[model samples]
Target: MIPRAVSKNGYAVLNAEDPLVYKMKELVDGRVVCFSMDENNPTIKRRAERGRVSCVYENGYVTILKGKWKVRVEKASNIPLTYGGRAEFMIQNVLAATLACFVHGISIEDIRVGLTTFNAGTAQTPGRLNFIEVGSCTVLMDYAHNPAGFSGLVNFISKLPNKYRTVVINVPGDRRNDDIREMGEIAGNNFDRIVIRAGHYLRGRDASDIAALIQEGINRTGKEPQVRIIPESRDAIQHAIKYARKGELVVTLADIVPDDISHVQEIRDQILKKQQATEV
Candidate 1:
């Protein structure tokens, strides 16, 4: 249905690295412009060799290859969303978005400005890896609920400086048991500590039941991290942030993004006030 929906002149932005998504290239009714994090991807390479258009992450830049012409939109390090080129998923996102804009006749300089100017953690997009610092603790708030979403967060976390990483996860009650479990397993495998927040929009599942299911999956990993369930999201956030020391990270997969961000912002404000008082 996807390919069939496109007119012959329409553009289909496809991912060459994803086998399933790349397969759509064969079926697309419109012109296909592929993007990939791998510059040397066989399909993308072949497209470049044949004088076709492709976007790739070559060296440090998000480069567009138009037959021998290399147009670099921006370096991943310069783009705040990619988190200093460490967030591999964001790199792919940048590639796709840059290619989409380019095909629509957006200039390279405009694309570069957009990439460098867009800050995901601002008030406009607070639930996207917004960091709040309180003394030694680095608290991150994001709205990662599903397995894939948590997996992306985990990928970003892996790129962060070595620290005692603890994730305060809140799985939506409405998701499938498998999805919740998968998120739990991902957190278990990656984080050093896990705090499960049981509140808001649990659908039909009981709070305890939801927490237990996640803990069950975490048990499968044989990791040392233990599961603790907090019935209140605020308390869960506090618990995760309170005990963190220097060189430690506290990640909160928020159930309510606004509430979570506001709560952390207040915490940060209090800490800043106390620090100022101490200096005086």
Candidate 2:
């Protein structure tokens, strides 16, 4: 779609750090502009030297230094979708969208307004790091079913300040055993507690098969964190929350996002009711 979009005389906003994007840039005749978080990326550096790049973003600031205009926008965290900067991937997404708009002659103020107004909520972007507060615990629910997604979530979770962290995860039956194993290893290394659950879509394997494979992977790492298999995803979530306390986080890599989110909201409501009763 990207290459086809540029073929029709539309400007292409390339991720300069991506080698595939660099190759695509070479094949397109239409005006191609680049954006990058890293100034040192060879493509961005080369384009910036030739004044062909549209925008350069780093940390949370974006600069547009193309065409005879220079503009800078700082505090990308002002974009509500980034969750106060905890969702680093969302920041990059905002940068890319902002750069795309700028290249298409959109006003800076409009782009800024659009970004700051966007929020990641259940209604807007369900199953993508939907944050919920249960009593004193923070729960992050996401549809991260693969190793790459798991790694990114773990990296994000590691930065949050919490006394203990719990993760709800399950291995997809269709995934390679090594991939499933890697997911378990990542959870084991990053979280203090883990709940292995079975999602609605098993992809062919029996109920206990995926859990056992994931557990085997976790055991291979030699870390003895608190881990259990609850089989049902919803029950696993409830189990995690039952033991959660203040200054803790529960990150759920949900397989069934809608069901998981509904269950979490129900759990949150119950927590709120209990707290209200105690206070009253």
Candidate 3:
């Protein structure tokens, strides 16, 4: 569909790492610009050999290759959206966005400002990796519903310090049952504790049924994690925070963005107040 829309003069931005996407270049009548995590990716190498343009992750920076010249855009570790460059998917997204923007003549300095200033906060991208601190634990809220997103999330969680990880997941009922189960399986395999909750809309399925499917997936995973079912989103968030160990993390795959963040913030405020009262 993307290639179908590009004119002969327009450049098609592609991910060199994805064989399937790189193959689409054959279908494109226009010039192809590529981005990749690997600087030595075959396509990126071939493009470099010909002095074509591409964006790549090199030495911890998002670098652009123009013929033989290497232009550094920004460090992935400095961008808040990539969580200090640990979120590979976010970095790839940044690379793709940067390549597309450059293809249309967006300046490198403007891109740097955008990357450095932008963040995955509630005020910016709500429910997209928003973090809140309560008591001795940190809460993470992200809107990850599919397998790919969940995999990226799992990777992010794995990179954190060796602390107890609790995830309050509430996948949308609109997804295929398999996907929901898969989410459960991934969460179960990684997190130390799991809380399955109800999404904003259950669509046609019952909340209990959705929870049961997730439970089934957890059972399929031989690795056992303590699992709980709190059908309400608010209740689920509270449960995760309440049981969070000192210096641990409570992660929530939020269905409702701002509402969930606010809910956790309220909890944090209450915890702060109680601590203040005790100090007196």
Tens digits of lDDT, candidate 3, 1-280: 8886789989888989889998999889889999999998988999998988999999999999987889999999999899999999899989998898887899999999999999888888888888787899999888888888989988987898847999998777798999989988998788899998888878888988889888888888998898988878788888889988998889888887878988899889999999999999
TM-score of 2: 0.85
Worst 10 residues of 3 by lDDT: 154-163
Taking all chains together, the TM-score of candidate 1 against the true structure is 0.87
lDDT, residue 207, candidate 3 = 89
Q: Model 3: clashing residue pairs?
A: 51-67
| lDDT for each residue of candidate 1 in 1-280, tens digit (9 for 90 to 100) | 5865767988888889888887887887789999988888999888988888889999999999987789777889999988899878788889989998998899999999999999878475778878777677888888888987788888888888857988888787889988888888898899888998886888888888888888888988888795678888878888877777677899988777888888788877877899999999
Native-to-model Cα distance after best TM-score fit, residue 254 in candidate 1, in Å: 2.8
**Candidate 2 runs further than 4 Å off:** 1-7, 11-14, 20-33, 65-70, 205-207, 278-280
Displacement of residue 276 (Cα, Å) in model 3 is 2.0
Q: Report residue 189 deviation for candidate 2 (angstroms).
A: 0.5
On the 0 to 100 scale, the lDDT of residue 162 in model 2 is 84
- Model-by-model lDDT, in order? 0.84, 0.79, 0.89
lDDT tens digits, residue span 1-280, model 2: 5565565567777777778766786667687877777656676666666867467666556667654455776566667877677676666677678888876778888887887787788888899878898878999988888987788677777777887999988867888878888888888888889999887778898868878778888888899989988988789999999898787899888777888899999999998899899999
TM-score-based ranking, best first? 3, 1, 2
lDDT score for residue 225 of model 2: 84
Candidate 3 deviant stretches above 4 angstroms:
1-12, 22-32, 49-51
For all predictions, the C-alpha RMSD in Å is 2.6, 2.9, 2.4
